[model samples]
Target: MTSTRATVDHYERLAASHDHNWTHSGVFLDWMTSQIVSAASIGATDRVADVGSGTGLFARHIADQVHPAQPILCVDTSRPMLTQIPTSPEPQPVVAPAEEMAEWVTAGGGAGTAGELDVILLKESVHTR
Candidate 1:
């Protein structure tokens, strides 16, 4: 069996290519953005979580719409992927595994500002878990 650390390292490498592949498809991003925006109203003061936020593409877009008041959390197992996110004043990015998110939720850490997440977006990373 692969060690957890090795698995994480592997994902970090994969993340480097994630944006190149996903962002190239404009249609996919547009569809995803529309869905995310429609489902989680951009202006709503909600606690949102994005799991496997590869390169933070969707998270960044959502943050742009939501702005400073709303809290958005970008969680990903890949450190490299998390680093690529723009250092903007909006959403905050956290390096973590999707399955381990409950710890943060229970402890009220990172993106768990108010309490439980109002919206949790898995995106295309669900099957990986």
Candidate 2:
């Protein structure tokens, strides 16, 4: 039967091409980003988490809105997928299941921060929840 392990493994193999398949640089993505960012009301100071942030499809755009203030956490179960994001020096990527993200945040994976998330996005990861 298909399970979370199988899902994560699949993503690990697909990580490199996930962005391309998702048309990350295309118009539809741009519009989606705008809508999500607007709906989330993400600001420079908002602490955000892009759950199921495969290849950073949405996290990259969210970063532009939150950068230099605080990096948005790119939380995903697959290490390969998390690593695909072009994020650095910001502690942006956290390898964790979407459902357990709050524990990671509270346990100081994102230390020195409050035990709350300002914004959480699960656009393509709703299945995980």
Winner by lDDT: 2
Per-residue lDDT over 25-103 for candidate 1, one digit per residue giving the tens place of the 0 to 100 score: 7776667787778876655577788887767888877776566366577887777888887777656777777657878
How much does candidate 2 score in TM-score?
0.80
The candidate 1 region of ten consecutive residues with least summed lDDT is: 1-10
Tens digit per residue, CA lDDT, model 2, 12-122: 788888777753555776678779888878787777888877677678866654563776777777889878877575537887776578677677554565456788888
Question: lDDT of each structure?
Answer: 0.71, 0.72
Candidate 2: which stretches are off by over 4 Å? Answer: 1-3, 65-68, 106-114, 126-129
Per-residue error (Å), model 1, residue 120: 0.8
Residue 112 lDDT in candidate 2? 61
User: How close is every model to the real structure, measured as TM-score?
Assistant: 0.75, 0.80
For candidate 1, what is the lDDT? 0.71
Error of 1 at 57 (Å): 1.0
Show the lowest summed lDDT stretch of 10 residues, model 2.
108-117
